[model samples]
Target: MSTPLRLSTVILPVRRWHEGGRRSWERAEDLGFHAAYSYDHLSWRSFRDTTWFGAIPTLTAAATVTERLRLGTLVTSPNFRHPVTLAKELITLDDISGGRLTLGIGAGGSGFDATALGREAWTPRERADRFAEFVPLLDRLLTEDAVTHRGTHYSADEARNIPGCVQRPRLPFAVAATGPRGMRLAAEYGQAWVTTGDPRLSEAGTPRQSRDAIRDQIERLGKACADLGRDPDTLDKVLLTGFTPDKNDPLRSVDAFVDFAGRHAELGITEIVVHEPVPGTVFAADESVYERIATEALPRLG
Candidate 1:
């Protein structure tokens, strides 16, 4: 039997009242959201000048505020963090959240995060190599008592973890991967795999185009899992839906939202993460859109 469809919302921690962000997480939990996530960027695109909070601390606060809502980053990269330090932080967070933390990791992307740290920009291949090493090392750091690894991008010297994660073996890893190399990492190490679809096919196209890209990616992931002799059913599939209500939004109507979710659910998406509206927008000020989703969209998804 397949897992039921789950819903998640991305809450970008950029509100004037940081406490308001906590309230947003609480609201999501109350609204029956499966997970509440924020982006793991030092500064996000276009909102680079805005008041942004670190993903770890924001998630920590969300954990403290909400009893049951799972908290995580939409996708965390190793652009600025070392495995040794990251393992400790994640383990502590998992403990605090009572083992309801999901680590969504991706290959480091080039842009503000790279330059902000005064690090040289690396090629795509180099980034993948780094991630290939990073995930396994971090996995060991979390599951093992002591780990010593020396790699090209990072090194851990007799790193010791005291009181490892509350989740036995380690917390769940929800790895984001849209490429073959990254998919292999996801199959090897991830408890779940997430995809936002191919930008080339969907960025300038219609909602149908976006769904098509996601379908292709999902098929590719299934093949990747099979190639590794891994059961695809073991990995939960998450689709990051890029729909934020605005004028001419494709998923504007309640019916549209339900249909859109159903299409993805049919494609084997266990979880769909819709991007939260920007603060001060009509959609953000009033959460009728989300409320309708809870009522009309969620039940039909299963």
Candidate 2:
């Protein structure tokens, strides 16, 4: 049987505090969201000069405040992480969250974060190769103890993972991949494959065009899984929608949200994540929209 569609939302930690963050996550839990996530970037594009918290610390805080909502990074990357250290940090987080942790990883994108920390900018191909190495090494370090390895992009010498993760054999990975190499890696190792859908879907395209683009991506993922002799059904297909709080947002209306989810289900997507507006402020002054989703749109989608 197909798995039921799961819903998650991303709460960007720009210009926010602990109490505010706690309130936001708690509200999501109360709203019956399956999971909540934060972005892992040093400085995001739009809010480069604003206050921002580290993804891990924010997530740890979120996990502590919420009892049932799963916590995750929208997509953490190798931009500034050493796989070995990152592995240890994630394992500790998994323990703290009592196993309600999902690791969302992606290839480092080019932007402010690419050159912010005195690091040289990497080309697209280089970033892809680094990501390819990072995921497998991280997987090994999380699952096996005393991992020692060397790769083109990273290295670990007798790295020991003691008092391992709460989730056996490592926590679930939600890998973001929109390319062939990334899709294959997701098929081989991720519990979920995540995409923002094709950019064209959001740019100069209608709803039907958006759905068609997603279907094409889904078919590509299926073929990648087949090539690796893995069942595509085993991976949760996650689509990220609703970037803004306007008509552009898929969750802007209850009917539109339901239709969007139904189309994703028809395309074999098992999960959908939306971007939540800044909580506890004028930007997100109306919490009714969220409540409506919990009481109306969500039930219909299910």
Candidate 2 worst ten-residue window by lDDT: 242-251
Q: Give residue 299's lDDT in candidate 2 (0 to 100).
A: 75
Whole-model lDDT, model 1: 0.82
lDDT of 1 by residue, 1-302 (tens): 87888888888878743547767788888888889888898997777886888989888888888998888988888888778999999999998899989999998788788778786877889889989999999999999989888888889998999789899899999999989999999999999998877766544666667777778888888899999999988999997766311222524666777777777788888998876666554224236776667556877655
Residue ranges of candidate 2 with Cα displaced over 4 Å? 243-247, 279-286
lDDT of 2: 0.82
The list of candidate 1 runs beyond 4 A from truth reads 16-19, 243-251, 280-286
Question: Pick by lDDT: which candidate is best?
Answer: 2
TM per candidate comes to 0.93, 0.93
Candidate lDDT values, in order: 0.82, 0.82
**Residue 149 CA displacement from its true place in model 2, Å:** 0.5
